[model samples]
Target: MSTAVATATPTARPTSRRRRRIGSTEIVYLALVGILVVAGVLVAMGGGNLFSTANTAYMLTQTSLLGFVAIGQTFVILCRSLDLSVGYVVALCSIVGATTMAGDPSRVWLGVVAALAAAAGIGLVNGLVVTKLRVNAFIATLGVGLIVKGYLDTQFKGPAGDVPSSFQMFGYTRVGPVPISTIVMLVVAAVGIVLLTRTRQGYHMFAVGGNVDVARLSGIRADRTVIIAHVLCSTCAGIAGLLIAARFGTGNALVYSYGLDLDSIAAVVLGGTLLLGGRGSVAGTVGGVLILAVLDTVFNVLDVDPFFKDVLRGVVIIAAVALYARRQIDPASSRARFRSNRRRDPVRSGARPDPTTTDGGASA
Candidate 1:
């Protein structure tokens, strides 16, 4: 009887898997590629040679410094923090590195070490100020940046000592048609990718940024994660500073002090890394960097006014952010939420449901 009953039972149906959705990061990357195509068209329209080897190399080389800084900024933002002091950190490190080099090739390593140490120290202080003192990251980092910039201004009026030959070589040397600095930027991005996607530390970082209270409940050290992120961000800025000094073969107190911090933030945020933290990817940030570089190149080729370019960029950023925000909602869930709200409404309880009613009970 048991065997007969088992045979008579109907077979269970297999559950269908939902198709995976394209995330904001991938969408942003696609948009970046589209922008590049548009930029190429603009260059052609402007009678500029966009496909020339010279232009390609120039774009890559120019992007390397900003790319490195943006990668670091991505890390910090992923941890739900901001590091406004990176611009000043870059300035201070470049000046210190060049001064230590003193036109002496043999001292290049020493200068590099000194610069990195200084950056790390500044990062540590920023971390402590945020994590220990409970200061808002924006205010803390900005204050620290002001202090660093003030000291830098007091120490040097203009460009300081010359960079060493060895240091300069790193920026100039190329593999075939590519600059070594570009290669370095690519490697840094790769490392960032691996760190965020494959490592335990990376998991903890996302957890912390996603929700600090939940992360702490889960035994993650949110404070330590933030401190580490700041240190890494500062280190990245220091590396960018070294590259900047190498490319210029000199360092100045104020040459690179402007716009770098803002650029990093813009690129990272545009890459679709959540400004609030938790979700992000290094690859998306790379696309973001490229988008910025392409836009700058196109604008220069077209001879657009610098002020107008800035305004255009601001508009683009706002548009990209708004598009991403709209994508965050699921139509199905939104409808379900509306239905749930209607069911709980006292007026709705006595009346028939109105499909056209909006959230505030107004007719759509």
Candidate 2:
């Protein structure tokens, strides 16, 4: 018998390149930041006084309030759900805070606490309806918003009067030349980022949004994750309402009459989170808010009519979504090319087939 030994096959080096050429999140962030910078430059060139301290402060303050709402919207959107009740929640909380505090500086803290509690309660109810009752998030939140709006209207019977002086400080006060509202917004964004990136709960949220059935089978409590997301979102909205009321020194019950949901959704989408869910970042959200604020300020400085602003916003949002969609599709082609290359590699021949491996061969 001739002793024949099979020649040892050299193992192919695993490609160090990441499977994903460009992460959607990274691309979205870069694109948003680029847009913001360009818009800022255009506004400056258009005599918008982009470098003025007052103008910068104004932009920060304006973005701060909307930013808070967008942050809340981020959570809901991440969970693959919608929260239509944010505007109503803001209106209700603002009314409650204004009427109860009503120029009583000392009672500002009480009003703040009450508003937050009310907001959280509303969020809990929304979560219960969606998770327990199996109601769709859109319809359920819409109905809840209407009910809250009606309830607030009944209580106010009209627009709210002046807010407390202490409460006003939240929106108007500054720290080392920075608006308090802006600081608060930054803090909220920071907290949200930490929660989503560092916690196990955050992983569960992604899993839940990515695939509810698979997450459930994998021992994650999808329902709880969604419910938590809703609660957190509403709480953020409530804080935003307080800030808005403080800024104007009054709560008109119609403060949220413009339907903030649409703007919030637009900001979230612009930030790179898919409407279908499971992917995004708080940093991207901040960029999106800045972009919107810049655009709004530019339009105002240009003396564009408010109605025209809506048209502009619609166009920008559509464009952003289209770009994002294109980016999402780009990866598929790269993946296919990678698969083809692997299939043509001779090293794969005569190996025990392993479908789970990217190269379709057993690991050496």
What is the C-alpha lDDT profile of model 1 across 1-364, one tens digit per residue? Answer: 2221112334365465667878877887788779878888878877777767778787788789899889999988999999999999999888888988999989998999998999989989898999999999999999999999889888889888789787798889987768999999999999999999999889988998899999999999899999989988999999998887898888867855468999999999888888899988889888888888878877777888999999988888888788777877668868966876875684865776443333343322
**C-alpha TM-scores of all predictions:** 0.86, 0.85
1-364 in candidate 2: lDDT tens per residue? 5544344455596675657566655766677567667766887778676646776687787789788888988887888888999998888888777777878888888888888898899999998999999999999999999998888778776668568776788988987557989998999999999988999988887788788899999999888998999999899989988887887788768866866777888888888888888888787888788778877877776678999898998898899889888877778888877886876674764456434544433434
TM-score for predicted model 1 compared with the true structure = 0.86
Which residue pairs overlap in candidate 2's backbone? none
Model 2 spans > 4 angstroms off: 1-25, 335-339, 342-364
Error in Å for residue 72 of model 1: 0.8
lDDT for every model? 0.86, 0.82
How does residue 207 of candidate 1 score in lDDT?
A: 93
- For every candidate in turn, the CA RMSD to the true structure comes to 8.4, 5.6
Q: What's model 2's overall lDDT? A: 0.82
Clashes of 2: 0
